[model samples]
Target chain A: MAEAEGEMSSLLEEAAARRAAPGRALVRDAGLIVGAALDMAARFRRDGRLLAFGAGASAADAGHLAVEFTHPVIVGKRALPAISLANDASAVSGIAVSRGYGAVFSTQLRMLGRPEDIAVGFAVEDRCGDVLGAFAAARQLGMLTIALVDGALMDRTLVDGTLVDHVLDARSGDPRIAGEAHMTTYHLLWELVHVFLDDPAPLDGPGTAASGCAADATCVTCADTAVPVHVTELRPGGLALVDTGGGTEEVSVALIEARVGDTVLVHAGEAIAVLGGDAP
Target chain B: MTGALYPFAAAGGDTTREELVMSTAAKAAESVELRLRVLERLGPSLAACARAMATAFRAGGTLLAFGNGGSSTDAQSVAQLFLTPGRGGRRLPAISLTGDSALLTALANDVHFDVVFARQLTALGRRGDIALALSTSGGSANVLRGLEAARRAGLVTVGFAGSGGGRMAAERLADHLFVVPSSSVHRIQEAQATLCHVLWELVHQALAGAEAGGVQAGGEEASDGGLGAGGVGADGVGAGGA
Candidate 1:
């Protein structure tokens, strides 16, 4: 087992070494293209919508990227223009069966994608009919295109004259790490796109992060959210109360407390908790 | 030993309480492991399929789910999860192919069990609709038939199956086949419940633009509580606390 572990470590080192190469050349090139993508995203903010597509690992990446744009973590941030192509199963299957799997995303791009919209194509393997067709259709529609291709399969011609404005070969490491790396690449890109949207001063400041809301947490009742009521009657599950907000509207069987004038979050049909108290 | 152990006696030895408990635990762990591995490996594909379902519903398309036995129950549970609101937002248009006894019995007895799901798909499915089928073995004839019919009807097919994906994994009928590897029915069913719950939650997460699916406002969002007069009567399809 020790010998096996030693051999595995050596192989990982070699793969890592290969990735960190290009003598600053590739870094400069990637920076330029990433800059271009940021600009295109700014253009999308103006008049275009960005549509992302992929299958398998690619699909997850597309969804993750779309979520970042659609659901910005920043509290007051408005959503940017974006949609994930992989999210529509009907379109994919319809195109796959009728026109072939290759035309699945391509058909949708042709129909719904406007000239101002951008198409971001992610391909895990070299020969993907769906990816190719989507790229072609997006180009024909005169929309900006970006290809996040994996490893050494970087055939520059795939993007040549077509509307593919940027190609970032994320030269991701070995088979196991490749998919995850692609995900990380896009996650980073999603954040960078946000940088293009917000002002520069806030960019220097710490970026906003997601709140850690668990699956089981209920909405905590506080004075700000719930309307106060006076307990008029008590029922089996909880309480009945008269609304303090206005004319004698009655609320029945909510929360554990039936004490008159006590506020509670009316959860479900029944009130489940007391205001400013730990949720039951 | 229980009566169920008699079948196993023919191939091996008598079943013991210790063995049954240990095996059940092992099977549960194995099933959970396999499910996590598949999700980790096929994250993008599954996420993509889920996203498509979300988009289809958002664009006025409906989601339909089906299966046999335990899978049938799972289908109903998932449909109910979506059709009802737990915390946030209103109910989306989702239907379980197994919910209506009249339709199921009619399709099962008149045509054949194999055509039960297929015929339903034929009648209801349209372009941009999503058809989700669940089977632990992934080899249910009725499920496969339904998948074929869904494909013919231009609906996206997603299958959740187990044990090396069986026929559904190989037939290419499922655009996405999430295979839970363990063979134990109990473990697979438990994990299937978890998987569907996650998908249902994701649908809500995507819809509400919330990070997690939390309990929000319940019924009384509107006069009819988001359900139309004739559509989805006051069983309060979208009413549930947490």
Candidate 2:
């Protein structure tokens, strides 16, 4: 009896100790997390939908986050638009079967993502190819990309500013601990986003970039207008340089097949469709 | 276009950026503190439950998990953790009852939403198997029905609930019930996830000890010997009709 009691205490102590570091780390990164929440609120104000995806256990996190946003539990909390790419098993499986597993999330993002949308990807480890692919597709769509990843990803540069705009690290070697920390971080995100949204003060006051809108003209991204532009050069990572009549600008051509000299409809810094005729 | 359209400057407000950051930090700290307290309070019961689960697993029993909303996703995660533990942890047989949307919707549409999990448990549960239910509110109709079904089917019923275990505890539906003493749904869920993780680890520990001790078969005997004689008897572990 004594031995069993000792074993239970030891197990409990170990479990408690394992989770401490990750929780402390989350508290330490509160500033960054709040900043990300502010940005998310800005996107939401622009009527941007949140698209979240992940693989394995992280898939559950994606669904959990989506449901929280789309169906607010607390009374008086407004429901923000959100969807989990991992929720539809048929779509995920079909995409995997036709284009391979790595293309599942990217394909969905290409079809569903908009310029003002927010993309949040979760991964217990940094090595999930599907998550990285989805981030690439999100960036190409001019969506604000956020990554919730394990501590090992903190040292990696693969998900740098080029792909993910905000990276929240769980900072735990153990997957279970990291997963718990991620839940806390995202819960904080959901709460803070509401806080910012409910606050009367404008998120982007006088000096800041105009609501952090990627487009330069009329905020057409939120306006749901697509303008025709001529592609001048194709850049790496699915980016294309386009001539918008006023000046040259860079846009994402990931959704459609676009080549240099091709006229494409650019909306929210992304080429939505390729026009067959000459640039207007 | 104009500054009027894009008003997101750091202007004067009752709540500044620093205050928001501080609020977030405080929430995180509160979550951490709640988790620690819950673990400290429920550690013994969790350990006992893990031993029971290990025994069931050794006897070729499968784990069936169910819940609602956020708890539903958490149930799926718990199943995934056991089915594909990774990191050299042994794979276990498990299924999330919430995985099949079609069946769930059908059951809810045809009969009622409250019986979604209950109907699945009635069909799948067997003697000595494990039924793990999660509910942040502790009063989810579907979760309560699922536990009742598991108990009827002679399965080892375990529940993770918040706000004092509600109907599950009141009715004594679960042989083992771990409740997070929090009113906030988010904090309850975050702590529940940690609870599941700790339970998973403890089960693995018990299984490893069993393997090392060379007690392969006879699940009840192995559990009794491994846990120490009379330490956690059949009644204490609720060995499902033993």
Candidate 3:
């Protein structure tokens, strides 16, 4: 019993010490990136968009970040003019097999990217032809580029000609952070960029963005015309009911149904159900 | 209050050792306390990471999660927290690297284990993607290889590991390493899961706040776009290769 008590005490102390490690360094770097992101937003106001691409975990990051821009929880947000190059299956496969992986991002950038746009690459390091190609395209297009990399790969000169404006390096090699850290980095970036775009303070005057044409306090999706939508509660396998108010018309009930009070995305008067809820 | 509310108290409940009440209560308290401690230590780093993701997201990027075995489940958990909201709002875009069996099996069968993640990285990765990898030991060959791929691809590399940081800690593959400081897999996993959940909450709060204020993260509204069934607010089409 005494030994157990001592062990417990030691554990508690260790946990406390671990908890106290300062995060100011990480936060500061994050701040710089956020500032850069805000600049990107300002450029976007001039009709520019942000483009992201990656493979595997990196690919997942590209897709995940793209989603946050497209859909938000807060009421009255607008869809950002950004795209994830990794979200298209045919495009990626066709490019990968025909042109090789290096051209994947560059190919997309050539057709869609503009000088006002911002291009970002998420990698543990700053090598590889695909990453280089994308960066080169961004540079050639006179677009701003940023790289998120690990400390081991922090030498910005490797990319040449200031291709990367900011580098957030963790200086650690834990594989989990390969995913976990991203959740942290991008989440912060998303918030900081929003702050610049919205100027949350009502005292800051009007925001630059326009409002959507939805009926609810939280509706962010808008169309030129008000499409009628009928929402109904859906039950799948007699498990539970889901509300489909924010649902789009093409929402597939093959997995569930549309329901009232459910937040949904509507396009052309069809119920395109969002994931989560009752859909299997 | 119900009239019968005090029945148990009025009966002077017999708290006996045979009931295992004492040990159970003690254990629960200890668990809660340990969790609290872990959170306290990791709060700032975790919060900062979330903030970073929010920023990247507003700028248009992707979030990718990967892990092995139960840790793979952790990756899935991370993906779900963003892609699907348990309550309030809609989904966000996120993916678990372990979600597809065909991809995993094929990679393992056709290529070396070290290339599992790297190959995917080469095939799908580009600039501005976030590569998130999880490994309790921080020494999984595939995970290490994946992180290398992420780095080479210019993806933001992040990791979650245990012990004195293992190879993940010493090698610098991750831009951020959150170590559990313990060799016990159970304890490390528990803490990591908790960290992921907290991150989910933070991301939601930040994004929801931004959207409510009528601001766009990626220059778009926060509501209608998403990619997966997990509820990430993705737009047009589904997750592609890798």
Q: Which prediction has the highest TM-score against the true structure?
A: 2
Model 1: share of real contacts kept: 0.00
Please state the CAPRI-style docking class of candidate 1: incorrect
Q: After aligning candidate 2 to the native by TM-score, how far in Å is the CA of A9 from where it should be?
A: 2.5
Encode model 1's per-residue lDDT on A1-280: one tens digit a residue.
Answer: 3543343334334433433332122333434344444545444543667888876435545655676667753445557777878755576677667766656677678788765577887765443346766776776655667777766444455534233566666555232233333443454455445444543222112111101111133322111234444444453222254454443433334226456556555532235456643222
Worst 10 residues of 1 chain B by lDDT: B228-237
lDDT of 1 by residue, B1-242 (tens): 21232233223443332333343334324433544554445554555566667666766677789987546645765665566533333576778897577887898788788998999999999977889999988899999999999989888788988778888988888876787766655446545554565565455444443222342422222233322111111111122211
Q: How displaced is residue B3 in candidate 3, in Å?
A: 45
How far out, in Å, is residue A109 in model 3? 1.4
Tens digits of lDDT, candidate 3, A1-280: 3543343344344434432221223433443444455545555554567788755445656765666566642345566766778657788879767876667777788788776677776654332336656666665655667666544454445333344555555443432243444444554555445544554221122111111112233332223233334445442211122233454322222223444444433432223454333332
Q: What level of docking quality does candidate 3 show?
A: incorrect
TM-score of 3: 0.40
Q: What TM-score does each of the candidates earn?
A: 0.39, 0.80, 0.40
On lDDT, the leading prediction is 2
TM-score of the A chain in candidate 1? 0.60
Best by DockQ: 2
Give the Cα lDDT of each candidate: 0.56, 0.78, 0.55
Tens-digit per-residue lDDT, B182-235, candidate 3: 654544665675567666555555565556667686523345332212111111
Interface DockQ of candidate 3: 0.03
| Alpha carbon lDDT at A241, candidate 3 | 24
Query: Model 1's lDDT to the true fold?
Result: 0.56
